[model samples]
Target chain A: MRGAVIYAPGDVRFENLDDPKIINPTDAIIRTVATCVCGSDLWPYRGAEPIGDPHPMGHEYVGVVEEVGSEVANVRPGQFVVGSFATSDNSCANCLNGWQSSCLHREFMSTCQADYVRIPNAHGTLVATDEHPDAELVPSLLAVSDVMGTGWYAAVAAEVKPGSTAVVVGDGAVGLCGVIAAKELGAERIITMSRHESRQKLAREFGATDIIAERGDAGVARVKDLTGGIGADSVLECVGTSEAMRQALHSARPGGNVGFVGVPHEVAIDGEELFFSHVGLRGGPAPVRRHLPDLIDRVLTGRINPGKVFDLTLPLDQVAEGYRAMDERRAVKALLKP
Target chain B: MRGAVIYAPGDVRFENLDDPKIINPTDAIIRTVATCVCGSDLWPYRGAEPIGDPHPMGHEYVGVVEEVGSEVANVRPGQFVVGSFATSDNSCANCLNGWQSSCLHREFMSTCQADYVRIPNAHGTLVATDEHPDAELVPSLLAVSDVMGTGWYAAVAAEVKPGSTAVVVGDGAVGLCGVIAAKELGAERIITMSRHESRQKLAREFGATDIIAERGDAGVARVKDLTGGIGADSVLECVGTSEAMRQALHSARPGGNVGFVGVPHEVAIDGEELFFSHVGLRGGPAPVRRHLPDLIDRVLTGRINPGKVFDLTLPLDQVAEGYRAMDERRAVKALLKP
Candidate 1:
């Protein structure tokens, strides 16, 4: 099997690796059908995040089951499936409460950018489609595994409602998908913060009613201006930076909500400031498994086309190029074929 | 008129003060019927907060309207009323959104310990009773102005639901009232953290089903054990210190909520830690005006008795003794008669 491995900053290589095997009775081995390089992947690729010891990368996939452990009954051999970046046992207390990302026996998926990948807690994590769909739907289905699912979580956390206003921070793939989610959730107005012309166009296509190119205080002023001197009813923070968090918090009206999905880095929130703002905040890794069935259905039903986020595609062997294109801002996201 | 003035830390003195007068068309002057020392007031008395110059203190009061400006119509002269510490124009956007504390024209009441106090935004901030209430209900009515209202807001922000488990951090008057709120909101179990025997007894009387005296890590462990290894469904943080905030956050299960009412002092929350916890956080000064009517009704109907939190009562002329007792922790709270 071949997979992408990170040796150091900007040093990704396509190398042959041993095929994964089931290590637990709850595990299953899936032959990767579709995979992708995510914006989060750039964290290590750009040296923003530490990379220690060479390891396989990737956490998004739509694959076909090759084999299953004895205990895995929900998904079996030959079934096309979608799974979340974070695997859960489905029946744990946290999972029952609809927070599968915090499942007691949770394991985050990595090493998915390969021909074959071993899935832990497969019986609970994998949701098999009734039948394999048309090839063109692969990208959207793969998106339902992470980015799209995450976007949905962001909207839910922000408590977006019909006839309410929503603001999306960050123009990355997740933020673009968030625009779609907010629209689908019945938000009357969708505002996205994006400076890149191409990304702004895509955001508008996804139902953004307004766009603010300004970044700090000026951006907040624009949001307040649009929101009648207050702020939006909901703000989806899709970037994991202190500046993005501050913008998201500032863009919400008192009693409004800010749902942050980006993995925060060195962000410290002042308790007094947050209290005075009177904004509700809830953020974490998206509980994708909890929304898998509904999102996959949305994709198959043609109600939403999140696949548009992938502006570039590459063969699995050229995964290095996929990372490079996204890192250099040449592609919003790159879909990889395995 | 007479009032309690704080000239320095531990130096509260009963002094003559100028009578308050209506300065705005929406203002009303109320003759003080009752006012009380608050847990927050201890901060200034203990030197935890700066005291620039001698100033009239106190923000909680139940009084009779002595005079009304030309624009005041909701309550007329001689009407008994209950008012919040924070006054607001009810027609503002934030007030209409149920966040009166964040109202556009909000003004915090700070001279209520005096014989007479001017009320700003009186048309929206004062809720007049149908008639003079029995003397027995005066204490409870006074509590509704702040402590009880704050506790109710905490329960609401935490989203307490029927059959859910709730935890109250802090054993002060607000925390005790929080226990009452959780019970009223239909929480099946209420856990209160308190080290003081008297406060523990009071908490139990206020519907606290369990009490954990442990602090810090041990306290959180106890909460987890009682909540089936996950924390409580909702946690009401009534103390403002960093330690209290951390305890409240850690005492809730993933996806649970923490409604913090304490005015935080120099507290900073790490964004990454909060994100991984999957907990929802919402905190602010309570929108007392929003809950005034309901709380007043509860008090008058004998459904709750938050006034029990006041263990020491003093004549208005002995205001200094009231402050001294509360500052020394000799009384849970002090009630004053003007």
Candidate 2:
């Protein structure tokens, strides 16, 4: 089997790899139909993150079930499915409470950028559609597997309400989809900050009522002006940078909510400012499992076509270019078909 | 008028001074019936906080309307009333949204800890009761002025569930009343940490189901054991110490809420822990204005007896001794008859 591997910092390769076999009773093998480059993929790709070894390179994908283990109950062979990036047994207390990402026996599928990926806890992780989706819906369904679900969680965690003003601080694919999620969740006004034309266009199309071309202060000021100086009722911090986090915090009203989905890297919360301002922070890794079912419904019903974020597509053999297009800012998102 | 003044650290004196005059058209003069020593009062008394020139002390009181300014409409002359510790016009957006402490023209009454207090925004700040209150309800009505209202806000901000376990991390008057608020809010199990006998008794009388004498980790462990290894569904942090804040955060179940009302001295939030654990934090100076009316009704109906927190009493002339007793931990809370 050929798979994408991260050999070291600033190194990525498509190499022949040994195929995976079922190791758990709830496991299943997926033949990858579509995979995509994630904004988080830039971490190790650009050497910002330390590479453990030549490792699995992708965490977002949608595929067909080629095989299922004996104990796998919900999913079956030869079915089209969407799954969360993280795998977990659905029966655990944490999973029952809608936090499958923190399930007692959670597993990460950060290497699913391969042709054939093995899924643990398959019955709980994968959601089967009524029928196989057309090639057009493939990218959108793949998004529900990770980034889309994450963005939706960000909106929900921020407690986006009907007719509320929402500020989204990142313009990556997930951030663009956060605008979509906020809109779908009934936010009356959505403001996204982005200097790039491609992302800004998609953000507007995804229901952003306004766009701020500035990065930090200007962006937050524009948001404040748009909201009549009250700031946003809900702010989503999709970028993990300290500046982005601060901008998100500063862009909210005194008693507003901040749903931060960006993976924090060297972030420090100012105790005094937070204590006095009364802004509540509620976020973490996208509880993708908790949101997958709703996202799948949106996709199936064509209520939200989030896969439009993938403006560029290529064959699995050209997965290297998928990363390059996103890294070089030529595309808002890139999808690869296996 | 005579008022309580702090000349310096460890120096409190009750003495006659010039009577307060209205500075705004919305102001009114009130004759104080009772004023109390708060847990926060000990900060300056113990010299934990710096002393400037002689400053007024005490933020909680219940009084009668002696005079009303031209624009005062809601409260009238000679009406028995209770007002929030922080006065606010109920008309502002922040106040209307239930965050009155942060109202644009809000004023604190700490400077009015004398025989007569000049309150601003009397129409929004004061709520008149049915004629004079019965004698037995004075202490309870006085509590609705500040501590009980703040504790109720803490419990609501913490999102206390109808039948879930909750942990209160401070043994002060507000913490004891948090036990009352938690129970009144329908928390089935209440665990209060207290080493002081008087506070423990008050907490139990207010419906604390269990008591943990240990301070930090041991206290958290005791709570966990009581809840069958699962942490409490809600945590009320009524102590401002970083240690108490950390304990409160650690004592909640994943996806739980922590309502912090203590004026934070120095506390830092760990972004990683908060994000990964999915815990929520929302609190500040309690939105006392938002809860005052309902609390007053609770007091009037005899559903709560918040005045039980004060075990010591004194006349206004001995305000110095009142501060000393609280600073020395000799009284959990002190009440003064003006």
Candidate 3:
């Protein structure tokens, strides 16, 4: 199978790789139908996160179960399934508490940017639909594997409620999806910080009621100015930068909540600001597995169109181009067909 | 009137001052029955926090309402009242949202160590008992003004649910009060990290199920070991240092909550630790006014005896000794009678 591998900074190559096999009885072999390049992938692609060795890429995927291990009772071959970036044994204490991402037996799923990928803890990680989704639904279903689930987690963690105002920091795919998530959660006003015209358009399409192009403290000031100087009831931090985190924290009113889902990069928070802000902060690698079933239902029923985030699509062989497009901001997200 | 004033580091003087009088329609002048030195006062007393000039001391007090402003309809003259250190109108958006400490019309009450103190927004800041309480209840009620309320906020913010395991970082009076608060909230096991024998004793009496005489990483390891290596379900951070904050965050299981109530000194938090730990952090100046009704009832009924933390008592004229005792760690807390 040909998979995308990152050998070094700016050195992504598509080459033949050994096919995946069921290594654990709880694992399932998934023949990838759709996978994508995520904003997080850019961290290593841009050499922001150290890339020590040649590593197989991609974690998001929606695929057909080509083979299932004997222990995988819930999902079987020929089933269309969506899985999160990380696999977990759903029975663990953390999983039971709805933090499947931090499950006791958790493993990151890599090499999904190939023809076939092995999924560990298949029974807990994979959420299969009643039937195969239509071809057009692949991109949207793929999103549930990570981005959409992450956005949903952000809204849920922030306690975005009906009739409340929500602020989303970041203009990427996850941030756009957060607007949709907040809207689905019944937030009356969704404010997204985005300076880009195209992203702003999509943000509005995803139910954003307002947009502030400014960044940093100025952006927080803009959010406060819009919300009667009290800040939003809930702030979703989709970017992990220190500035974005600060903006998110500052953009929430006293007693409000800030839900951040972005993977942090060299971020340091001023504890004094957090202490005096009187705002609640909760985030992490989202428990996407917990929300997969509901998000899949929303996608299948046409209730939400989060797939619109994929502005570009490529064949699996063109995975390098897909990475470039997203890295250079040419594409919000790039969907890859295998 | 005589009040305790901080003239310089290690210099506290009890001297004559002008008697407080009602200046606003919402103000009420109270003849303090009982007042106490707080752990936070040591910040200025030790010169950790700047003391530019001789400043009136004390913010915690239980007193008789000697005079009520015309607009102070709820608290009447001659009524025994318990008030938070911060006075709020209780009519602003923040007050309505249960964050009276950050109310639009908020004012910090100072000079309460004096014979007479004027309380602004008396109707909102002061919670009057059904009838004047016995002298024994004054100390407990005085605690509600700050320390006890702060501890209660920590437990509440940490979401100390029934049957949960709670770990409290810091064994000061506030942290000790957190044990009591956790017990009141039905936490099955309350673990407090403490090394001082006296503090540990007070902590156990306040309902601590276990005491880890460890600090920093070792303290977190102890908490994790107690929780089967998963960490406590809730953690209350009563210390404002970075080390205490880190211990609180690391001691909580993924998806657990940490409620911090200490006035942060100079703390910087690593964002990655917070992001990856998946711990919920919420805190600030506690909304003591919000919890006053419930806490007052608990104290009045003898259900909780938080005032036992006051190990020393002194006459108002010896306010200097009261501050000295607390500063020297000779007394956990000092209660002063006017």
Candidate 2 chain B, run of 10 with poorest lDDT: B104-113
Candidate 1 per-residue lDDT over residues A10-57, each given as its tens digit: 998989999999899999999999999988999999999999999999
Ranking by DockQ: 1, 3, 2
Query: Which is the better candidate, 2 or 3, if ranked by TM-score?
Result: 3
Question: Which sections of candidate 1 miss by over 4 Å?
Answer: none
What's the CA error at residue A281 for candidate 1, in Å? 0.3
Docking quality band of candidate 1, CAPRI definitions:
high
Please report how far candidate 2 places residue B309 from its true position, in Å: 0.9
Give candidate 3 regions above 4 Å deviation: none
* Highest TM-score scorer: 1
- Candidate 1 lDDT, tens digit per residue, B1-338? 89989899988888888888889999999999999999898899999999998898999999999999999899999999999999998989999999999999999988988889999999989999999999989999999999999999999999999999999999999999999999999999999999999999999999999999999999999999999999999999999999999999999999999999999999999999999999999999999999998999999889999999999999988988998898889999999998
Pitting candidate 2 against candidate 3, the one with the higher lDDT is 3
Question: What DockQ results do all the predictions give, each relative to the true complex?
Answer: 0.93, 0.61, 0.83
lDDT of each: 0.95, 0.85, 0.92
Model 3 C-alpha lDDT per residue in residues B1-338, reported as the tens digit of each score: 89999999999999989888889999999999999898889998998989997889899988999999899999888899999998899988899899999888889987888899999899889999999998888889999889999999999999999999999999888998999999999999999999999999999988999999989898888998899888999999998887888888899999999999888778887778888888999989989999999999999999999999999999999989988998889998999998
Taking all chains together, the TM-score of candidate 3 against the true structure is 0.98
Candidate 3's error at B260, in angstroms?
A: 0.5
TM-score of each: 0.99, 0.96, 0.98
**Residue pairs with backbone overlap in model 2:** none
Alpha carbon lDDT of residue B219, candidate 1?
Answer: 100
Compared with the true structure, what per-residue lDDT tens digits does model 2 show for residues B215-250? 778888888788756578899999888899889988
